[model samples]
Target: MGALGAGIAALGAGIGVGMIGSKATESIARQPEASGDIRTAMIITAALIEGAALFAIVVGLLSNG
Candidate 1:
């Protein structure tokens, strides 16, 4: 159950990241001139989300271990 739960958490994270990428791409396409700022914000947001996902994965591993 521990590994199963962790896998599910990761699946959700993947979906969330995909969604963020899609939105960011659309935003950048709409305003090419703002690409720099949009890219920066998108990267920051992605990093933050990925960090939280990593933390959850670590906790899940420790708990399951």
Candidate 2:
């Protein structure tokens, strides 16, 4: 069960990252002049979402161990 939960969490994180990348690309394409700003915001958002997933994984490991 622990392994399964962790796997699901990882999948969710991957999906989130993918969505972020897709939107970021779309935004850059739509506004080339603001690509820099959009890319920075995208990276920060992705990092924050991934950080939560990482925290979940860490907590799972500690509990399972």
Candidate 3:
């Protein structure tokens, strides 16, 4: 169960990062001038998502342990 939960959290993190990259690319394409801002925002959002995912994985591992 712990392994399963951790895997799910990892999958969610992958999906979230992918979506963020895609959206950031689209935004940059649409507004070349704001690419810098878009990239910064994307990075920040991805970081937050990653942090949550990491926490979830840790919790799952601890529960199984």
TM-score of each: 0.88, 0.89, 0.97
Better of 1 and 3 by TM-score: 3
lDDT of 2 by residue, 29-56 (tens): 9999999999999999999989999888
Clashing pairs in 1: none
Candidate 3 residue-wise lDDT at 36: 90
Query: Largest lDDT belongs to which candidate?
Result: 3
| Candidate 1 structure quality by residue, lDDT tens digits, 1-65 | 66776777788789888998999999999999999998899889888888888887777777886
Worst 10 residues of 3 by lDDT: 56-65
lDDT of each: 0.85, 0.88, 0.96
Determine the backbone clash count of candidate 3.
0
Q: Best to worst by TM-score, what's the order?
A: 3, 2, 1
lDDT rank, highest first? 3, 2, 1
1 against 3, candidate with superior lDDT? 3
Q: 41 in model 2: Cα distance from truth in Å?
A: 0.4
C-alpha-based local distance difference test score of model 3: 0.96
Clashes of 2: 0
How many angstroms is residue 13 displaced in model 3 relative to the true structure, after the best TM-score fit?
Answer: 0.4
**In model 3, what are the clashing residue pairs, if there are any?**
none
Candidate 1 deviant stretches above 4 angstroms: none
C-alpha RMSD in Å of predicted model 1 compared with the true structure:
1.1
